[model samples]
Target: MNFFQFFVWGSWLISLGGYMGNQLGFSGLQIGSVYSTMGIASVFMPGLLGIVADRWVNAERVFALAHFIAAGALIAAAGMTDFASFYTYMLVHSLFYMPTLALSNSVCYNVLTRRNFDVVKTFPPIRVWGTVGFIVAMWAVDLLGWTKSANQLYLAAGAGLFLGCYAFTVPPSPPYLDETRKKSLMSSLGLDAFVLFRKKNIALFFVFSLLLGAALQITNAFGGPFLDDFKTKYPDSFGVKHPNLLLSISQISETLFILLIPFFLTRFGIRNVILFSIVAWVLRFALFGLGNPDDRLYLLILSMIIYGMAFDFFNISGSLYVEKMAEPTIRSSAQGLFMIMTNGFGAIIGSYGSGWVVDHFTDSGGVRDWPNIWFTFAGYALALAVLFLLVFRDRRIEDIKR
Candidate 1:
């Protein structure tokens, strides 16, 4: 169920741009709403809902209720024709929606800890299936011809509803907090992670995390649409007919690549793995800029292939690095801080920036100026790579391994 949440996102996340830009004639900023909505909601909803789960409610119940609420909002969104109304609706829905990412993780942690599972040994393997779920959902959406159509929400709505109900079936996870403790709402909700921002190195990492995050969403918000644009540039292209599934190849790559991480992190260390991700991002964008939806598609396909390294290398290794760096007492809080930077602020910056850039550079017809857009994004990533290499001080995984 947790895995499929990402699948719901992957189904339309990349393809929505094509629908908005090519099919519906919407503006780029309008297209950006998809990314921005997730970011905005991550800012508050996860914390508030998490607090409720911590003190008053069963975690599974909270999960089910959130999905149920999101399902109704998504179904209502399915009927929206205007962008503003649709945007507002999705935003509201996202408030209920984005927190589930953490809630699901929390639920899993509770279960695993209760069962005395070794999370370091067992969890990563299980979590890899979530990537599988994401890929499957993407393939399904693409194969079904549902990209950008209102019908895509039906897919997500069904998933949300099922997950909501199925959550109740999971072993109950009641709030663990003591009711008599004099806890402030911030502490209750786990917002105490904010204190990490006062430190210099951590703050720098988070700042760059937002910048890298900008690059991350660029492909997500644009890949399907960019590929689909090939149809217009050269008519009768495969992308026009098949954008969703082809973009799904990235998700497939994500699954295959995550398996390699343990070995890579052990051998190359966090800095090198992150370097691979940065370099991969540059390649990922540049390949799309050069490749076509037509015969030169090998390049396009290769770009999709590299997405695994570009996304997972940085994201997963970064997560592991946080685990290695933090004191045991504050380890969970450190993870929360990492998420706030990457998912919350980073996602917001990336979404709005990508939207503004795409919106401003493209003409009224929604045709993207591909090379310039991609190259500019690559440049931003290059800058982060350089800054991180210089400033963050490298520490080998072997040195950190317990």
Candidate 2:
């Protein structure tokens, strides 16, 4: 279930930018606008549908239905030639697809708990397969020469269809009809979690989450196309020839770094964990600015490797911090708020903002200044880190009043 769940996303997530820009000649803003669909959908879909799964429908069934709809949307998107049509189809797909990520977890947890497995211990091993699936999909697409073609979408659609059918066979997970708590669209939007803003530390943490979230999208939106550009300069280079495979290293690094998060959080405290993550972000972009497909390829590799630290530290650590700080009654809502700040608002900022940055650096002849663009991103991250260091204060969770 986990494997095919991510298999659907891995088939297209990293390579779509390359396809849109290289094959369809989309401008950076247009491409970014399209990628932002995930963010736009993410803002409301997951929470809204989660309410349905919790109160009205079986989660597995909802999960299955979402995948089936997303599959059709992917098929529609694959046939689109213009940005408007492609964006519309992809937006429809994102609306149904983004929520399934949470639904899959819900289903897994429900089944695992019913079978008497220790969720904390058993779920990680099972979940790691999702990353493995993602890496495998990246390699598959790269090797099949589908990176710049619409075929990746077709592949994803096939996977989505299969997963949708398979979801029904999972353990029966009925809605919790006894859940008496009122769940509304506004609460689902994380507006209830806005009360956390009264606390200075939590407020500051979320503000930085928004900023760093912006940094996360810069690489994802452009990294593949950046490597693809190298074909003009070093057609025979491995990075140029297999950008997806090279990019897969970041996912591989993610799996490794997630294992190390426990030690890092215990040793350094959450503040320093976040600091390390911000510093790593600075390197992630700077290394990209300095590296290439040839002599400086090592820099690119190093960047990919550090991505594990840059991404996992803040995201996992931030979630853990939120869990520790929020009262038990509001814990789930707190997590939802964290996702909203990062993936929702932050994604919108990152997608549109990075697209503008990319266009600003590109010449009228349509040649992008890749290094300068990366350097500019690095500078943005650096500023965030500096401001964060000055404004945020760390307090022990035990010391804070609930």
Candidate 3:
């Protein structure tokens, strides 16, 4: 369940921008707009479908249905030649696909809890396999020479279809259908988590999460195309020849960095750990701005390494922070709110905003000033870091316990 779940996404997520920009003649805005579909779907679909899984059907079934529909959408997207058709299909794909991310976890949690397993101790190992699946899918797509082709979408579709069927084989996760319990749509959707905004510090933390999330989206949307573009300057470069493989280093780095998060959180506290992430984001973009396929290839590799820190620190640490701060009853809802801010609103901002920045640096003949574009991103991240430092306050985990 974990492996094939991410396999479907990894097949296309990193490479789709390159495919759109290079092969389909999509402009930066178009590329960003396409990437934003994930954000658009994430804003509401997870909660909406979660309600379905909670009230009407088993989570595994909803997970399966979502994958089946997403697979069809990916196949449809693969056949589209125009932006409108492509975006429409991809949006359909996103609407179904994004929900499965949460549904997969729900299914896992339900099964694990029923089996009397410690989710906190056991789930990470299971989750790591998903990362392995992602890395494998990335390498498979790149090695198959499908990085800039529609074949990546087909590959994703194939994985999705397989996972959709495989979902039914899992233990059943039925809805909590008690006669005494009634939930309004808003409550079921976790909208009550919005009340957390009354606390200024928590509110500021969420705001910074949104800002840093934009940096993340920028990297995901453009990192591959940026490396692939090096073909013009250094056609023999390893990065140009296999951009997806080189970018996979970031995921490898992610697995390693995740091991250090416990120490970072214990040693520095949540606020400082997240601060490190914002600073890492600064370095991540600045290095990309300065590095190339030639002598500075190490910089690119370093950027990829730093990505682990940039990504894991903010997401994992912020989630821990949310867990610490929220009341037990609202904890799950608070987590959902955190995702809405980061993956939903933040994704929309980053995708569309970075598209404009990319277009700004591109000339009429379609030559993009890659260095300047990266530098601009770095500047944005730097500003976010500085602002986050000034505005957000932290309570140490020990203090929170008291």
Using TM-score as the measure, the top candidate is 3
Candidate 2 vs candidate 3: which has greater TM-score?
Answer: 3
How do the residues 280-392 of candidate 2 rate in per-residue lDDT, one tens digit apiece? 99999999999998999999999999998998788766765765566433433455567667876788899999999999999999888999999998998899888878877
TM-score of candidate 1 to 2 decimals: 0.89
Q: After superposition, how far is residue 49 of candidate 1 from its true place, in Å?
A: 2.7
Model 1: lDDT to the true structure: 0.73
Q: Which stretch of 10 consecutive residues in model 1 shows the poorest summed lDDT?
A: 327-336
Clashing pairs in 2: none
Give me the runs in candidate 2 sitting further than 4 Å from their true place: 109-123, 172-201, 319-335, 395-402
Candidate 1 per-residue lDDT over residues 1-402, each given as its tens digit: 657767666656777677666666667787776668877887667766766676678878988999999888888887887787778778877788877866776677667767987544455566687788787777787788878687777788888888888888888777655444235665654655566667665566667666677677778887867776666566777666777767777878887778888878778876678778988988888888788878888888898999989999887666666555554333445554565567777788888898888777788765679888887787877777887788877564653364
Per-residue lDDT tens digits for candidate 3, residues 1-402, read: 889998898899999999998899898999999999988887888766766676678888988999999999999999999999999999999999987876776677678767987554455557667778888999999999999999999999999999999999999988766543245554554465677888787888888877777876887789888987778889999999999999999888877776677677667777788889999999999999999978899999999999989988887666656655665434334555677678778889999999999999999987889999999999998998888887776656562232
Error of 2 at 108 (Å): 4.0
Candidate ordering by lDDT (highest first): 3, 2, 1
Of candidate 3, the 10-residue stretch with the lowest lDDT total is 327-336
lDDT of 2: 0.82
What's the distance in Å from true for residue 344, model 1?
1.9
Residue 295 shift from truth in candidate 2, angstroms: 0.9
Better candidate number, 1 or 2, judged by lDDT: 2
Per-model TM-score on C-alpha atoms: 0.89, 0.89, 0.91
Give me the displacement of residue 386 in model 1, in angstroms.
0.5
